[model samples]
Target chain A: MSLETPLHRVEGLGSSHSGVSHFWRERVSGAALIPLGIWFAVSILGLAGGHYVSVLTFFSRPLNGILMAAFVVISLYHLVLGLQMVIDDYVHSPGGKVVLMLAARAFALACGALSLYALLEIARVF
Target chain B: MADNPQRPGHRPRPLSPHLMHYRPTPTMISSITHRITGVGLGLGMAVLAWWLFAAARGPEPFALFLSLAITPLGQVILFGFAWALSYHLLAGIRHLVWDLGYGFDPRSANRWSLVIFTLSFLAPAGLFVLAYTGNGGYYL
Candidate 1:
């Protein structure tokens, strides 16, 4: 008896396919955000009442600085994805939705890049 | 009369379900809350990133941010943003728990959801009160 090959194997997978792409991306980003988010909350809490120099000193630590940069980038990317979904659901006009989603994504990337740059400067790595 | 009024050969039309007909489940409510908080966090994070950038720039920019933050309207917005941040963070951890193949039991899920919701709002509110009362510092 000959064994039947799995569907994907027989299909000879290439680079592209469709279905639930956005859903799973959001879920994975959501999962990563949990730990990144906890670290963020704790870090911010530690900075309570800290003045400018104090805050700078706190971020000057290499590990803390790196984590902050990662957290900001990841969180901002995740935020844009989540907001895009919300806009898609609520905004009925196609043109408006596309414009808004693009704007949201651009804003997120800009924020992420700026935050990362600031963290790097604080770390003296820039 | 058409032979295909309910013909097996014909494809069925898609029928969207009515929300009012079905009772909402714990999972459904939690999912909705997650999305709501997710959106809230999106806006909150934007503000936070802006705050950080301002601080990184110099005292002038930081003071500009602080002036807005110190205003009554700004205080309310900050409070709401904090609540959103806390809620989204807690709820997200709850989601991670579910993702790890635990907390699927209905009772536990419901209990945890309530716990997350309560703690999310209360923790931030408590801190805000403490700050406002000068127990921590003058946040207002």
Candidate 2:
């Protein structure tokens, strides 16, 4: 009385034949962002209106450098993944979706790389 | 009524239901805001990238970026970015909780939505007050 093939039943995959990797990754990143985001906000807010030396000195701190680099990488990755989901949801045309997805992904990667480079440069880690 | 030149056996794609017909609810608003804030944050990343690059570039570029960032229009943009960040963080937590199979009930979901909506505004405002009242004008 069932229509599903044996392979399908055994695989237990959805219509897209994919597991919950997307959902899991999004949630994991989201959770990580909470603490990291708070720290970032505090650091930046404190540095606001400060002199150039102050800003550089802040990043020169090893802990701040490490946290900032981590925050940048994770947040950009999360941003791209979330944008991918949103574009997939709303964009009707396959071509349009592909364009948006690639743009977002490339933007995220470029930003992430640039940010980490800046952090390393500030820390004088080369 | 079939056109002679039209392609045969093509099927129209299914569409998502229209949005206007449904009553607006907190859950719906939260869902929409989630997407909006995600976009806002995505856009804000450009500013962050620029700030970092300027810092790496040295004093003059950093000064340029800092001056632009402190202008009134820049402050407004920063406030909006901060609010978006706060809202997204709270809502993201709510989502993570839901993903764990809790808060699906109408009441809890609505409660979380309302809480997030209020705190998103208050958090940034509180930080502004704290920053300005402390020593120098550092309220971001």
Candidate 3:
């Protein structure tokens, strides 16, 4: 029933689109989260009732500091992507949707930066 | 603009067959809860950011943070978050498996959902038991 040639039909259907990258990044970040989340849960449970010094000492470890930073950055990025999808699906007004999306990105970035700064201080970066 | 038999002065408004249109099933409930929990966890991150800010501020502020964390209301919030975290973690894993094109059949999907629902509670309960037994000194 179609009249188009194979080459014509194939035009513009390629990997140049943004959707593929977004899909992969989301999945990759999710895969990264499993182990990182486990580590974080156990570590936080261990530090739950500790004083500042005790918590600081645990984070002061080189590997712990690095992994904590990675967790904050990656998780925040993933969070923003997930939130953006929800907003796009639910928000009908174009102007309101854009504003909400931008606000989400801003909030995630701010939180990620603050978390990194705090981790650095804990690890005595200064 | 013209009157119709069904409505003398107006036309029937277009209505979406929304939530009520579909019969509720386990998978439906699980999917909806997934979105709700995602939003809840996002809000919980704000509390976490506050904790980190206080911790970085030094011992006095951190102590103040702990004081607030242990209040009756604080404990409620903490335990709520723990439950949320457990449920979200299990649900997330279920989603990841689905992403790989597995568990689409109704029987397996329902079974997995039931398993997730049970384990969500058990995970947090186990943690509490450990803390109470003095094995999880972190909770003290």
Candidate 4:
């Protein structure tokens, strides 16, 4: 028989199967944040001189609402992944690391929910 | 050959490098700041989540939240959060440009990094001023 084995056998059987890809994913998220971040900044800046009602109206626009929702989701996802890396690096205790990661995920999810709710409210107001 | 460094009984010990011996570069510092802002953003999101939930709850909770936010400590935290958000956002953009096979040159990278640093603080400060004063009162 040849020395080479089946691809599945070489792929590894456990959680470590896709570990390398996770690092690349974190970088990819980081890259995405750049334009998203600038867009958010410019959008907020445009609202600077407006009143509360005007600000509300701006978000009330369908496109604006959609963009805002996208921003919220993307920002939270990036934040969670970034925070997870931080926890993994510093929280050496296994239990503490797991707890911290879970907490980070929960916080991100809460932010996402609140942002979506706020966007929906804006849509209703319009 | 018998003279080889590899020995049957003696396992080679890995050499650990000293951090102090390494030279730091702009890329290294940028990477570090990216991480710092990331953590800041996480904490900032917690504060923001609280604000959103409070606002959704009712006027009373919002008023309570507003009161807390107007305090000196609250303002500082908010200001810091704003900067953190801006920095992370700008830095993320820089990374995106680099990833797209653009702005990879040393000069352009440094220039963009400087722009990100300046805009991060400037955008947030401008927003705070508008938010603070445009509400007709000192705090909003």
i-RMSD values for every candidate model: 4.1, 2.9, 2.4, 5.3
Model 4 off-target regions past 4 Å?
A1-4, A8-16, A42-61, A121-126, B1-25, B100-115, B129-140
Off by over 4 Å in 3: A1-17, B1-16, B138-140
Across B1-140, the per-residue lDDT of candidate 4 in tens digits comes to 22346656888755555445568656666778889988888777667566545544556766687687778998898788779888877787677667679988777777777777888899888878766676422211
- Report the lDDT of model 2 for residue A58: 80
lDDT-based ranking:
2, 3, 1, 4
- List pairs with backbone clashes in candidate 4: A34-B92, A34-B93
Residue pairs of candidate 1 with colliding backbone atoms: none
lDDT of 1: 0.74
Q: Report how far residue B59 has shifted in candidate 3, in Å.
A: 1.0
Better of 1 and 2 by DockQ: 2
Q: Which candidate is the best by lDDT?
A: 2
Instruction: After superposing candidate 1 on the true structure, give the runs of residues whose Cα lies further than 4 Å from its correct spot.
Output: A1-24, A87-97, A124-126, B1-28, B129-140
The better-scoring model by TM-score among 1 and 4 is: 1
Residues B1-140, model 3: lDDT tens digits: 12334555877855656677899888888888777777777777777777777778788888888999889898778777777777777888888899999999999998888888788788877776766576665622
- Residue-level lDDT of model 3, residues A67-118, one tens digit each, is 8888777778778777877997888789999999899888887787777788
Worst 10 residues of 2 chain B by lDDT: B1-10
lDDT of 3: 0.77
Instruction: Provide the TM-score of chain B versus the true chain B for each model in turn.
Output: 0.74, 0.81, 0.81, 0.75
Q: Residues B69-98, candidate 1, lDDT per residue (tens digit)?
A: 878998899788777777777777777677
Docking class of 3: acceptable
lDDT of 2 by residue, B1-140 (tens): 22235446876444445677688889999999999999999889889988988989888998899788878998889889989999999999888888789999999899889999999999888777766676333432
